[model samples]
Every structure is written in structure tokens, then in C-alpha cells.
Target: MKQFCQTCLAGLMSVFVMFGFSISEEVQAEETGQTAYVDVSVATLWSEPNETRPVDAPSIGNPVDMWEWTTGMSYEQKLWLVGNLQTQALYGQEVTILEEQGDWVKVAVHGQPTPKNDLGYPAWMPKSQLANDASFSTLKDIKEFAQVTDPTAWLFEDKHRSDKFKEISFNTRLPVVAETKDAILVATPSDGKKWMSPDAVSIYSSQEDIEKPDGQNLVDTGLKFLGLPYLWAGTSGFGFDCSGFTHTIFKAHGITIPRDSSVQATHGTPVERDDLQKGDLLFFAYNEGEGRVHHVGMYMGNGKMIHSPNTASTVEIIDVFESDYYSSEYAGARRYID
Candidate 1:
């Protein structure tokens, strides 16, 4: 009887091993809850799922027309987007599904940390913009990854790069399947597979494999987007908000920060205004730096800082004390990189 029991136990262990069952994986899955990957090039998250207006249709569509969406909006309509839009998730970015509404799903976007949720920054996005396929979900397990390093890169349907697939934003990471001399084959969430030019992405064995860039590196990266339009809640190369610009720049260098300016103000190493260094975040608050944090910019030394100012302005570099509003509302500074 003992010998038979031992044989059965050994057989069960073999089966478990063969099926790739593990306690750690099970725990991780449970902790993660239901998850989905962003299927579009960039999915805009909203404060309210169904409250979007007709003007927002272009942005919510599968192939989002960001250029049209931003340029088509009037100044008043653009201002309306300030509090309505929460943030954006890039293609293949994993989000934990918190709840599901009629045609929308509430997801906590990973990488964009916030105090609103323990999982991540909470927001609502259309269900169609996300992929819950087993194949797509398994991409998190892949060790090799291709992280978009350029401001924007085109994913191609063919390795020759003739057929355009999608234009992915910077810092968008996808599972790398294979690589040719000049093109890399990557697995997309909804699309079967796509090819990207080697110049557009930096290959990494894992997230940890990405080298940490210095302060000057961050400033240089921000310089690439000079004059890019400012979009409320925007995080992509298409446009950027105050915090989003800082967040995306740091993310490209393998550093993740909070999604909102107010939340971001609380973290990182605090630096004095007089000792501001290159790449340090400069914050502005209401009530002349006494109230809530509202804006952020990257210090570029010599009293200059690059920032996405407001709905009316584009990303630009200016002296720290140039604007009367910013000068009066200069909150403080924070340093993420050593």
C-alpha cells in the first residue's frame, strides 16, 4: 500500500510539472486579478466611461486619429478634456480590470502609479480597446522584449517594412519573437505579429536588463519633443500633459513614476529650488506654492526648464522664473535619478 501511494504521488508531481503548475504563478495570477492588454496604439482612459462626447469618438476608435482628435477640437472643447480624461495606456500595456460596465471596462493601468488604487492608476477605457486573449496575456512571461526608444515607431505587417501596421509610442514594450538584420519580429496583443525596425527599439532580456540613464540623458530625451502639443491627460508622443511628459521621459529610461502631478509631488528625493539640477522635476502649485500641486517640468539647468504648459501652449523650454504664474506658484523640486 505504501509503495503504491509513493508511485501515485510521484505521478501527480510529474503531471503538475508537465502542466507548468506552480504556487507562485497561481498566487501572482490571483493577486493580479483579471487583466487585459491595450490593443490600440494608445487607449485614452476617461474619468467616466460613458460620458465621452461626440468629439471624442475619434480618440476612442480602434485606430485612434490623435491628430484629428486634437486638432479638430476647439479651444473650449479642449479645455473640457482637463478633468474628464484620466490618462492613456500604450499598446500591449497590461492593465488590471477592476470592473466592467456596458461597453467599457475600468482598468488600473500598470507602471503609472497612483494613490487612487493599490494596483495602479484607475480609469475607464472602452472594452474593445483591450485584449484578454490567452496568447496576449502570456506575453508577460516572455523574457525578451522590444521597447520603443524613438519618439514614435511604425510597426509593419511585413519584415520588409512596406506594410504599415501601427505607429506605437515611445516606451511601449512588446514581446520579441525573433530578429533579423534590420527588423525585429514582435508579438502584438490583438495583431498576430508585427515587424519593427531595429533603429526604433532597444532590445532587452528583461525590464531589469535596461540600463539606468543619467540626469543629462533624461533632459536630452525631453529635448526631442520640443514644441509637441499639450494634451490633457496625454502620455504618448502624440501629445503630453505636465506630469505625463515627465513620466514618459523617465519611463523611457526604465524609471516609473506617478501619473498625476499632485501625486508625483509626494515622492522622489526632494531638492531645494536654489540647488535644482538637470532632469529634476520642478513643481508648481495653486495659492502661490501653498496649495495643491498642479504642474511639473524638467529642469534643464541655467534656470531653464522644459514643460508642457497648458491647453494653449506646446511643450517648450523657458526660464524657471519667466511666467508670473509659475514663478509665484513654484512649489518645489524632486529628483528621481541619482
Candidate 2:
């Protein structure tokens, strides 16, 4: 018996994903800032097909990624890589380069939110590289980089000297696939750079295949990080913020969604608030007079939503239009799943 959400498109089933985690590894993410970390099934350039790995990890030795990282990842970002393996660029432009805090440092070209010029158009700016070393393995490395000073400057050169992670070869230039000044040099032997698991799992409980799961998969995969500590700008099952969670959940289902709620809201068709449905997006604006959505959440039917509220609010369920905190600031709603 398929339970259709009365509030949804007449035939759409109300997906009730109960995110839960085990005692040893319940990873839950918190929404804090504009940036976050994400762990996902990446199609790497050298991962092997049969390389024993978790569902979310890139196959060892398989050349080129299978489009793993959540789609619509803002280019001006810093992602925590778990392995010492070099980055095999597939797309996007690289701007700044350096090593900081034992992680591969980078400055990316992506869409950044900015106030309107005379045209009321949103422009892309080179945002600062935030050092969010949550990748257990990445946090252990000393190859780090940060976008400092004028991060908006697209042409920022770097020459870093870290005491940690011994230089494997200074003369040996790390091959950068992209047309960026960013160069990679092997760092000193740190702890274990052996983390290859992307920490992926099927979102469906009854499904057997790890590669794909139908509608149930989204909810099941989301529940994988039931209790992981929330981190701002997160986008992986290992730990994820609000948009990260939504992005990861949809990706597993073969659905491509923009990385942030603000962006995701634009990908799908608009729906009236009174006619909202399950899995739809609900936006909010604290400064209502400004009339711009500053926050977003997943409309989980029954007047509830699943989102990592604010820095203070944990990733939990609450009434959508009824929540005293959300209703007053409610901006609008949209849906992607047709």
C-alpha cells in the first residue's frame, strides 16, 4: 500500500526517512556557515573497479570520477580529502593554491552570493578558502592551504613551506589537469592517508544492491549519519549540513540537485505554499522586508520539515509552517521531484 501524501502531487508517496546511526558511527552534520564538508561516491581517475571500498568512496585506481561529489558544488570552496592521492581534475577552474593545516589547499571559481549591482544580478566572487579539516585522514595531514587577504582576487599565487609532510619530490611537478597555477607536492609522511571510504550506504532498507536504490534509498542513506556532529558547509554522509544532506540524499537516487538550498530552490518548479508536497523545498527569510530567502529546509509532509535549522538548531524534524521560528520568516516553497 503506497501512502500518498495528500499535500503532494496526488500520486506522490510521502517519504518518511528516519535517519538513524549505529552506536559506533552515527555521523550527523550541523549547519553553521555558508560552507560545509561532504563525503560521497567520487569517480576518481585511478581507483580500481574491484578495490574493496565503501559505497560512497571512489573506486581505487578507477581513472576519472563517476560524478560523485554532489552536483552544483560552488567552485569557491574547500573540501576535505581523506587520502594522500593527488586530485585528478574533471571540471571547474582553480584559482588559488597552497598547503595549510596538512590538507591540499585550493581556491576555486564558483558562484558566490553578492548584493546587486545596477542590474540586480547575482555575481560570482572568489570566496575565502575555509580550513574545515573534518576528514579524519585529512585533518591528520599537514598539506594545507587557505585563501587569504583578497580572496576575491582570481590570480593569487602561492609558495608554501610546511614543516610537516616531507617533500617527496620538489623537482617532480605534481600534474594538474586543469589550467591553474596550483601545483601539488607530496607532503611529509603523516599518519595514515589510507582513508578511501566515501562512507556511502543505500538509502533503502529492503534494497540489496549498493549501487542503486529506488525511492527508499534516499531516506535510508540520509539516516546513515543520524548522530554525527553537525558541521557548517558539510555535504557528505560522514557528516552533512542541511543542504549537504539534501544534496547527498538526492544524488544517491540519481537525482542531481544544486548544492545549497538557495540554489536548489531554483532547480525545480515552483509550487504554492498551500499546495506544497513532500520532498519539496521551503525557503525562509529572517529579514522579511528584504524579501530574499536566507534559509531552506526539506518539506517532509505533515507540516514538518527536516533541516539543520540554525547554528543552534540540530538536524531534527519540526512543523514547517507551524514552527514559530520558521512560519514568521517563511519565504516560499518549490519542488524538484516530478
Candidate 3:
């Protein structure tokens, strides 16, 4: 990736700033230190709105919605566990990190964000690395998460877990790198490297891992609807706005994210376009008036994104920085599950 001027890359000007990449369908061999864990916690529910208290509060039983990590702090790793069983997640909702009190979280969710709640991301994740002796499963046998439901909201199920809440699942994973220096567990061997020692925990969750599957088709399947139609505050399949489309995609993949384009920027770890991974989100503030994001898209790897533009625009795929529309509106780039 060619370098762009830092000053020019700020604000909407960054939108037009262009870069190019080449993506492939090859699954590289194993290497050491290739694992990670997404440190996920249920968003704390608010009791009341102090507005001035910094954090927003929710009514009783509202259920805290969406999963959040600091910029560069949270990431979903892509681990090739069990032949080809892998998972990719995008937070498909609105989240606002509160300031103080509940201020650490900003919450606006169409669905619930906890395991006990009816609406949550439920999947079977592996607690250990792939079997060194097992052969890779045929792609035909691997099942995509969405095939299991409609109006899908993420919820976890512990098929291998007898502990009820503690599930033993084995899928590819990512890490929250914003808060830490290295990636976490449930890793695959990259290149020729050996497994990395666990950093800060005894157990890890692959659901929080970054979104890099073993094949290009995974990313392709996640971003197939690059340009559909932009709807205002839309969270459905037929018509979706920029943030709406992005939030929904990640939801199907089993990760809850902030809703609005601006607030969504605050979740996950921060990464430059040059270092972006698939399923990561990109944000733009064509008009940085509210200190928020007006336009957003999903980083489908390579140089393309899946997003919904304005009322006059169609949900489609376009060069991130190639058009003046995004160029002039470009905000900073962020990676939630990277």
C-alpha cells in the first residue's frame, strides 16, 4: 500500500485517499503464534438517564445490547480449526461508549446482547487448537451461520460445553489488539511459527476473534451485498443504510457492534487502511460537525467495501477512496474484530 499524507488523510479528505490491493483464494500453511481471543463482556445496562452523568442508561429489562472494545483493543482472529469450521463476526447494532458511570458504554440496540437474553450471538467455539492429525474438511461440509436462521441475531450455544455457559468450541479466532501488544489464544500455526503461549487468561473465546477465514469465499460471502440500497436507520435485508448494512452483516456473523456510523468508530481496535482485515469496518465523516461518522462500509479485504450511500445512492461496492463522495467524507479507519 502506498503512503498518503497524514494531514490529507484526516477527516473527509481521507475518504478520497486511495490505495489498492490484490486478494486471493489461497490458504497459507501454519505458523507459530497464530492464535487470539476476543475479550468480550456484556455491555452494562443503564438504570436511568443522567445525560450529564456521561453514560446513558437503559430501562429495566432493556438488556444491554452490542459488544464493544476500544480502538485496537478488540479483534476476532481467523483460525482454521477442525478442518474448516470458522467464524466471522460483525456487530450489527448501535453502541455508544459512555464516559463515566455508564459513560464507558453508549448503547442503542435493536436486539439484546447477553446469553440469557433471547437475542444474542450463540455458536460452538473450540477451546483447543485444530487437531494436528486431522485432514481439512471439504468446503461443502462447512456450514455458514446464517443458514440456521432468519432476522438473525447472535447467540452462543455450547455443543461441546457441558458447563452451561462455558462452551468448548473450535473455530478460527482473532484478538483484541488495542489494549494488548500481542494476539491471544485458540490460534493456528502461521507460516512455520509455533503456537503462542497464552498471554493473560486460562480460557479464550473464538467468537470475539477477528474476521479472517482460510479462504477468499468467506470474505466474499460476507461482502456479497456490497451495493444494495441505503435506507435510513435500516436494519433489514431488503434496504439498508451505510451503518445499518454493516451492523447487520456482522450480526449474521455473530458479533454485535455499535449502530450509528460515528459511534461504531469507537468500538474495536484502530487500524490504517493498509493494515485492514476482512469483516472490519471503515468509517467516514463527510461532515464532521457532530464529531461523528456519516458514512460507513465493511472492509471486505482487497480494496472494496460493502455499504449503503445516501438517499440518492444505492447499496453497492466502490473504491473506498476513489470517489470524492467518500474521499471528502473520510473519517478515520477502525477494526473491531481484527
Q: Report the number of the highest-lDDT candidate.
A: 1
Backbone clash total for model 1 is: 0
Consecutive 10-residue window with the lowest summed lDDT within model 3: 77-86
Task: Score each candidate by Cα lDDT.
Answer: 0.88, 0.37, 0.38
Off by over 4 Å in 3: 1-218, 287-291
- Give the local distance difference test score of model 2: 0.37
Worst 10 residues of 2 by lDDT: 147-156
Best-to-worst lDDT order? 1, 3, 2
State every prediction's TM-score relative to the real structure.
Answer: 0.89, 0.41, 0.39
What tens-digit string does per-residue lDDT give for candidate 2 at 1-338? 22223235222221222333222112211112232121112212111112223432322322212323323122221133222212221112122222111222222212211132221111111122122334432422322221111101111122232233211100111112122233222211112131110111112221122244343344444445555434345443323456756765664454656656666656678888789777777788757614666677777667877776543445677776776768888878777666
lDDT by residue for model 1 (100-173), tens: 66677889999999989988889888988988778866765864899998888999999999999888898899
In Å, residue 62's CA in model 2 sits off its true spot by: 21
By TM-score, the candidates rank as: 1, 2, 3
